[model samples]
Target: MGTPTDEDDGVAVALRDAVRTLTLDSPHNRNALSSRLVTRLYEELDRAEADPGTRAVLLTHTGNTFCAGADLSEASARDAPTDAPLGLAGLLRTLVAFPKPVVARVTGHVRAGGTGLLAACDISVAGPGATFAFTEARIGVAPAVISMPVLPRTDPRAVARYYLTGERFDAREAARIGLVTCAADDPDEALAPVLDGLRRGSPQGLAASKQLVTREVLAAFDRDTDTLAELSARLFASDEAREGMTAFLERREPEWAVRQTPAR
Candidate 1:
């Protein structure tokens, strides 16, 4: 077992036998997706891929919140090149295609892009306290970039409702919708049994199985370029997007021009 290192403030890497554990360390920000942290995460994952000693990877986070999603402050602060880093996107793709088993240990609230991270993993175990939300719509943005990956884990109706409303749901709801494998009172205890089973499996067989599943899913879907383009343009131009960004920076509620009517 390799010792945990403190090189990256938002990530900790440890190797134990054939398994590598990657912990998101930014508890204060709920491990928000900062640019530096994203870069480091990609580097660490790449390293694990190249290392012969590593056979599987486990991703977890510290704090009451697993991940709240992108660093909104950073996103709003940047004047030029508003998109997330290309390397970050590449890392997400790599995670989805990784030959080795990738397990996500979700312990708390996870939202927006955080859910994307969970979806990219091969398997996921969540604590009872865990909650999830698709919050881009609330901020007048679209999750188009991660929609492809998340779609496989959830039902179309659930996606439509959550994507439009940006409402939160509990872990039970997440599991019921197929977004999570299971919800456990004790995540570590629940995962230990599964990990033991995985450890006994043939590495090559596991890798092949993952590849087969991915291939089958990808074959059934065609890229929706029109939808993606529309989302992109809308997010970039929306007044609410601007208001949300500014409100987040100023730590206040966004003043949408049109007030929502109360439900009867």
Candidate 2:
């Protein structure tokens, strides 16, 4: 394992054989997609892409929650920018279009935009401890931006249920619904053969093969990213979203969610 980068960097790169494992290290916020973390991830990805020795990239996390989605604290700030969805869209596109195979090792909870990250990967292995949800609707926003990557890979019925209900599901369901490639009790052991195969693959063959499978996903990005990102920005800026986000941060139900008693 390679030496980790500065802890503040939010991402750590470890190289073993030809695989570059990029670990999401920002456990402070459950590896949420903050602006800083996203920027750092882009930088690390660029390095891996430019490195000829890197045959594949493995994405994982340091904490129990693989990723909890967007940084609600940042999103709820008074001066928060509304371009988060645009940045997230670009990152997802990068993963989908990456020349080398991008794989995910998810062993914890994933929510909202984090699910997009998993969907964008060419292959993902989820451990027994992994759980996933499309929780955007619960926060008063549609899973619009993530839908670009997710809808192409997941079952339409499963997508509808999760996106609309924001309900959590286990790793097996994730695999069954096409969200993850496989679910395993020992993810690392299961990943060993996959990584070995990737390491032995020719660079040209790997890149070409990835391109074949990613065309549909890339097309979705081209067709819907702009519109979806704009929709996300608009939704995040609305009054209902403000109330929802605030309520979430405050650990209380939003006013709209509170039940009213009938007058006697």
| Best of the candidates, TM-score | 2
Q: Which regions of candidate 1 deviate over 4 angstroms?
A: 78-80, 85-88, 216-239, 257-264
CA RMSD of all predictions: 2.9, 2.3
C-alpha lDDT (0 to 100) for residue 32 of candidate 2: 95
Instruction: Report lDDT per candidate.
Output: 0.76, 0.91
- What is candidate 1's lDDT per residue for 144-178, written digit by digit as tens? 75665678768889989999988899887888887
| Candidate 2 lDDT by residue in tens digits, 1-264 | 466633456888888788898999888899999999999989989999999988999999988999999999998887889789999999999999999999999999999989998999999999999999998888898888888889989999988998888899999999999999999999999999999999889999998999899999999999988899999999998888988999999999888875779999
Q: Against the true structure, candidate 2 has what lDDT?
A: 0.91
Displacement of residue 62 (Cα, Å) in model 2 is 0.9
The lDDT leader among the candidates is 2
Model 1 residue pairs with clashes: none
Error of 1 at 162 (Å): 1.1
Clashing pairs in 2: none
